[model samples]
Target: MKHEDEMRRRAGAESIAGGDEAEQLDQDTLIHELRTHQLELEMQNEELQRTELELIEARDRFTDLYDFAPVGYATVSDKGLITQANIMLAEMLGVDRNRLIGQRFSHFIMPQDYDAWYLLIVKLFRLNLRQQTELALKCEDGSICYAQLHCLPVCSAQSNAIRITFADISEYRRIEAEKRQYEEQCRSLFENMLDIYYKTDMDGRIEVVSPSCLAQTGYTQAELLGRRVTEFYIDPAQRDQLLSALLRKGKVNDYELILAHKNKAPRIASATCRLLRDEAGKPVAIEGVLRNITARKQVEEQLRLSETRYRALFEQTSDYVLVMEPRTDAAPVIVDANQAAFEKHGYAADDLIGKPITFIDTNISPEAVAERMRLLQSGDPVYFETKHTCSDGSTFWADAVARYVSIGDSNMIYSVERDATRRKQAEEDQARLLRENRALMRQLMQVQEDERRTLARDLHDELGQLLTGIQTRGEYITMHAIDSEVRIMGEEIVRSTSALFDASHASLLRLRPATLDALGLSAALTELTGERQKQADIVCSMRIDGDIDALDDMRAIAIYRLVQEGLTNAFRHGKADCVNVIIRKLPAHAGRDDQLWIEITDNGKGVHAEADRTPTGMGVIGMRERVHALGGTFMLTHVPEDGVRIEAMLPLDHSEDSGR
Candidate 1:
């Protein structure tokens, strides 16, 4: 300001000294213009200062946007060093921004992606245009991230660098991989599935056919595609019907149709279809799955025929066949009956259909029927005999076979019955005749025993007295003496008479045991056993329990004979070392009479030595007949250990007074 004042004063003096009024006016005007110019310069300076402050604010905003931007940004020098990196880029590489600057950017590139990154940089600088490439980027923690890099080359006064933007594309790549895998799976199913998949246009022309169509229809893809679908149908009209249904319902499930194969054989197929429509919702094509059901249909036909045949056999059989439902709480209820059953029972089918089985049964109780059914539950059949009453009140026996059958969900009893009346009647008649024969045999044996007793008595009365007299005379002769020769003759005669008397007495005892008539059955058995043991040189034992002596005379004699025959057989045929006899009387009880039990066992080689052990001999026959005649049972069986045992149970009828 002082220098300008000095310069103005000096210029003022010079203009005054020149003595020109016009020059002095020009100096004053010049001074006014100078001052206005200075004012304009000051205003411009203030405007510049305000513009500088606005520029600083804008720079701060831009820096904030760059640091916080979602995309990772970086600047790489031509040497591949990171000259600048945004906060996002630093975070992407898992490094601090301060540590990221001036670092080799290639270090963050994955080993496998190094070449790609190098090529990308080369291409960016070579073209000097925006370039993009995908790379796998590695973080400091060794984790991988997929990124697409968009790079642009930048030139500055100091050096050249590449500006790059990183986009994370890991999720996009993962979705692409999953889509490819899903397509492959769909392709595999279409090619390898057993059922046929197909598509047809509105004109019934085949459009798409899966590979399985060839195996199911006997037509290759070339022959089937672009062909009319109805041409394969046995009845072309059926295709129209199916299409109409599909259009109306939007879908059809499990529709059956017959189609002609390439070889002219008929094929059964089950189809499930949907109507495929255009954007306007108008039906344009049909898509469906077709499954070959020829084998299944054939099996069903065979089963139907088999069932028909079984029904025929079940109805036409001669034997009475009936099916019944068994119940635990009641008798079995009849479910069905064949023609024979209806006729035999003299009832119409309607009458017996819902009736209990006991309706026709005469003697079988419901409990017994239930028991038989229970036994049949083991999956085995049961055979039984029962009597049934006819409509006329006459009963007849039936031989029945029953089986438990499970059909579907029902438990039933199937029974076949045949008339067994005649057979049972014959068995009864034979049994009665046998009883009569045994009665006659008992009478004959009684007669024989009486004659033997009479003979024994006669022998004891007349012959015994004569034998005694002869023995007495012999003694007298031995006591007296005469001439020597006469005396010798007398001694010889005495010896002979004594021997003859002894012989007569032995014969009498053999004919009839006097002990039996005098001492009762117990003493009789003892004497008989003793004599047999002494004669046979064998061991013999007898056990008589209860009051056997209380038996009637006839039964007592029978008991004696039984023991006698048993011992004789043991010695003669059994070749036994020992014989055992047991006899006991059983007291009367409910449904049974007073009885005698006799058992004869021997330790001898069994009757198997003589072939079968059946009682074919007369002695054995006599024993059985006597027991049976007295309404008893007889068994002659081989013992476990090389012996035969005879067991007899005889009912006693006491016609005489008890001797107990």
Candidate 2:
């Protein structure tokens, strides 16, 4: 203000001194100019002060933005030293702003990143370009953090520096690493999995296929890409169906269909698919997985065929079939029955189902049924014959076969029954006929024995008397004859009569053995053996185990006849040189009498093979008939290298009672 006052006084004096007319005018003008200039200077000074205040506020705002910003800002010198750092940068380094100044920026970097920082600084200076990199940095506390560094060149009057921005990105980097690892795992699974993974455009054209496509569809991944998905379908329409369903539901699971392999063979596959959408929610592609189901489909088909055949057989078989489920320890409940079972039992299916197994055959006790069920559960099958009562109250014999079967979750019994009523009746009829035949045979044998005895008596008595008289007359004529010729003729007559008597006696003995009738079976066998030995010039032996006298006449006759026939056949047909006969009595069995066993063996040439092949002759047949008539069994066998043997067994008690 003083200077301004002084300058004002001086300007006033100068202007007054020059105050003549022209001078006074100029001085007034100068004073006016000076006053105008003074006012202008004051206005300008106020404008400048206001402008300076605005600049101070702007600088304050700028400083606040740089120091407290979310990111750290710093200036590094050409020598890689920190020249300036914002409060954020200082905080990031866990150091005071003053402490950070003049510190080597590389020192704040991790040791492992030293070369990277050095290279970054060199590149910034050389290219004066902006660059960004991510690296780890060490804080003042020695803790490490990940940061993204963005560096740009800065030029100032004093020196060249690089301005750098640091962003803390540790959490982001951790998340990125995890995401990469997860993607790698998914890629591995997609490539190596057995199932095929694929992506298709909305037009059903394949855009991506995993490596498994080659093994699953017999098509290379390259061959599949860019091809219409329907091209691999056995029925092209199937793709349309799939798309329609997917459009309706937005996803499909286990949609099964047939696909044509590269070889043109059909393969079954199950697909799980979903629609892929863009950020705008518009459908872009279809992503899916396909699994080969050809083997499972084949197995299902086989099972279906097997079930069909089983049903056919079960319904068509003549034998009655039943399926029953066990009810704990109780009798099994009938669950199913075949056509035969329903018809034979005269019951409707509804009536039989749910009924106990014992219900069909009332004769079987509950305990017995339970026992059979136990056996069946143990994997044992039970077979038995019983009388079964039908729904109509009629009874018939049945043969039942039962076994355990498992169907799904339940254990059941499967039974097959056959009607045996006709068979049983036929067997009874056969037994009756056999008994009647035996009775008639016994009577016929008795009558034949009676006739033989009468013939023997007549031949022995009358024929012997007649031959004796003729012999005596011939002897007298020969003794009293006058001429030699007459005597010689009478001698020839006596010789002829003697020969006739001898032949008659031998014939009577053979027709009816008198010793066999009077003495017993043993004597008859002995005499018969002796005769065969002499007549056939062979050795014959007889063995008797029990007392022959104990046997009744009828039984004795049958025995004698059997023995005689056996010996005759052995000698005539077998051409035997030696014969042995044995008769032994066996002990009695329960409900049976003592049995007699007779065996005849011969040491002669065995019967001819051709004769054995031919039907049995009447002689052997007769022997069998006689033994059968006495309720005995007879067997005739040609032993290899041991001639022929005949065996017979007779029940003594049976023979004795029948005769009486």
Candidate 3:
């Protein structure tokens, strides 16, 4: 604007001087000079008008921005009286713009801030430098607002006015209060919880310590603060690495570690760490919690030790170790049994599992086991046992200890079995050994019983028949060539001989059945059981399923012997009116056909072995060893209502597979 004014004045002065220097004035010359001077003046006036309009538009734009700024903006005279104020500042003060003008700022300031405001004004006047202050202002409505005000001397000395811009912080203050309340609640919780909580900077310095950490680590907050986290770690390097990982991954959980506390003792703890990131996703700090798991760690160690000690003990155990569950169905079902449990009771783990415990143990009746199942549904526990049968039809002794335990939070029954087969077998073998044999003494003690049976059968077949033939000849002679009295005596002799032979033959067959060798086990079992069926033929049929050709002789022999013993118990001892025997190959898996199964089922009086302890029985113990000798399993089941079932499984691990 100043440049335009100067140019207009120079042009006017030059034209006036040119006119004064002219002497002759022709009509045409005079007209041209006047018109040129008029044009110059008009151009100057237009230039001045354009400059004025431009200045007005620029001032209006600035004024609008100043009044409409988000923050409170104002201008004041040197005397601290308001010269101009934005609508925001005017509204904040609960005053109209017209009313706010010319008012002294000190009138709107809170009483407590009067001295601060005075000091700020003095600083701005003296130093002519920009300054900022936080102060409270009392609005016309009697409400107080927090603000950060920055003031600077904007105009020259002559103008003597100050420009101020400020930010209102009332909303920020409210949010801070809420956050502080939340932190206090968290602090209270940390002070009482059994778990430990902590926070750290990105550099691994422990910045915040929860009160629970004191109880867990015996360290004071002051002792922990600003300290490198590695200082308290049992493995300092591990601790450093974990912190670095948290910074990278943003979060980690279930991290196991050992920490040395103030007492200098290491405590096993599981720690979780989470990173606090900035808006840019870069880690700023870490927060985490820890739980002292020393007890659980100790338990794990003890279990490992137990397994080592029990490795050899499994073979030598006097009592069977059974993992059995009670019954299922309308009755109780035996679920699972270990090697020893199955050996003592004559069953396999797979056979017994998923069934009721009653299938094997008979200590508790089927009805009782059913009631106990109800108890389990109500989260209660019960104890019971039952007898079981093997696939080859053998019985066994077993004892179990069972109780409900937790896997995490789910409930499950934990059973440990102590096999009592050896003890019972030792007693039986001792009682029966001396009466059986001499040269075949210790080793032949078992075979002697079978030999006795064979001898009886020989006597019945050979000697008894010879005597009967002789008696028949004699009777014929008496009737034809002698007297009536002699004939009667001969008939009596023949009848007595027949009775004696029958008993001896029956005993011989029981000692050892020769049919076992003549035919496969399935055939032998069917024939042997057919004889028993005449007396106890409550069951309709007995059958075999699945491929059974891969079994070795010993395994076959074991199964056959088991079946003989099992049938005796089911028919003669168990008073079971009905029984079913099943022999089959196991489920076919790819590259696996090493398993064969034998199952004997009966609905009769159950042998209730105490679930808490092993019971006695030679058939049970013998069947157990036989199955075990083949590197397989034996398990027994004593059902709640349905009676007892026994299963024996053997693995032909050496047999070649067809990859079927």
Candidate 4:
């Protein structure tokens, strides 16, 4: 349109120039031509004015488009200053449009992004082509935003500047970063989780598998992908069953299957699966987690076998077994019983099934029933001796042991009753025999004491006196002899008589120590210890506590004999170097009346191990019998690396004494 106006203007000017020669020929024609020229100029001026208005409108449109564009546009001078900044550019920088003019563009760039911006600008000018870069830009409010800058170098005759267009891409970059992080997390879970995660296509061909599949199925991701899922199953039918379930239910949980490993070993697995469908809701693939359940399956099998064995034992045992359920009223109700139980009670199985457990027990008193209830409530076993009545109206003793047991979900009492009638009778018989034997033993011990006293008296009176008289006669003969040979014969006779007297005295002491009857227990023990020390050349010490002299004859005699036997054992058998005897009166305490403690210790080579292995020796048996007969406790211990010790505790009160 401008070119057409310019052509018309030039043609008018040429026409006027050509008409100047015609004006000299005719004045009137010249005036008319001037008038036409004037009209033409007026028309030309109107056209020019209209064209100027159009140009102004177009310029306004261009300015508005540049300023309101989605992207920020700016012209930057070679010095990195902003020569022109549109409204979007000012808004992107968080500044007013007028405030951005002549401002250094580099000021808006983050310090860390300065180098990138500088290099970008340099490249844009050096290549004189469009160059782009992403950088963090600082806004007027000190906030940071990520942006992509596209720059085109503008080098013209009038000015040298770069036109740059940038967009605020902070939100896009933020979303991209979040997406990357989510992908990383998902990848981590897929690779590191223990259970097998897999995806399959509609055809049952493996589409993808996690790294864990390698460990779960002994097949790597590479090996499993693109392969048929049924190929790994021990029975392909199992896969078919799984697919059928998935198709029918749209999902399956804890579905058991057997899959074969690379080594051809069958593995038990439990799978939880769901259908993966498209937008059309058609099942495209199956997604699931498969967990190894081999251990659980093995445990289940073992439990099944164990239950079988337990059932066999429960049915076949000879001891009567009763399974009863506890009730609020009366005793427990007998729910079931073994054949032995019915046979022992002389009742048909039907007769006892619904009856209370107390019906079979002849002596189930209220207190007994209460006690059993208490034990059951506390989850403890009940063990007691009770008599059970049979159908014949006769009763027998039974040792019943009942415990609370849980079978499935029901709580019941499992009882085993053994026929204890024979055992109880045998125990009574043994007790009677033991009493009779103890009575006979006491009588025998008394008789033995009498015989020993008599023998000791004979040796002391008759044999001792006779030996004394012979020694006296021999001594007189030696002193009054008239010849030396007769004197020598008399001296030899005296020596032999003296030896006989000594032997008789020693024998009398062994039979019954005279001091025991004459001077009480302490004096007798002192005398006995003295004799052992002298004979064995051992150091013997005695500690007699309390008033031992107050003891009666029977106790004194027993104590004297016990000490005599202990010292003799220590000196003769133990070959002890020192003997210690302690007799102290024990004060009465709860559960124990006043007692006497006699402890004898010897520093000797400890008692031989073989001696312990022996069932009984005469000396030890005699000591134990004497102590037990007096209702006392006796202990003989050979201290390791030390010596032998014999201790006895005899109750002072003889009211409960079995020996008497």
For this target, which candidate reaches the highest lDDT against the unseen true structure?
A: 2
For candidate 2, report its TM-score: 0.55
Q: How accurate is candidate 1 locally (lDDT)?
A: 0.84
In model 2, how large is the Cα lDDT of residue 395? 89
Select the stronger candidate by TM-score from 1 and 3. 1
Over 285-305, each residue of candidate 4 has an lDDT whose tens digit, in order, gives: 999998999988999999999
TM-score of each: 0.61, 0.55, 0.35, 0.55
Model 2: per-residue Cα lDDT over 474-526, one tens digit each: 99999999999999988998999989987886676656888876787788788
| Winner of 3 and 4 under TM-score | 4
RMSD of each: 12.1, 20.3, 21.3, 13.7
Error of 2 at 158 (Å): 59
Residue-level lDDT for 365 in candidate 2: 87
Angstrom error of the Cα, residue 251, model 2: value is 8.4
Better candidate by TM-score, 2 or 3: 2
Candidate 1 C-alpha lDDT tens digits along 242-356: 9889978999999999999999999999999999888999989899999999999999999999989978988899988989998778888999998889888888988889998
Query: lDDT at 459 for candidate 3?
Result: 73
Task: Select the stronger candidate by TM-score from 1 and 2.
Answer: 1
Q: At residue 552, what lDDT does model 2 achieve? A: 82
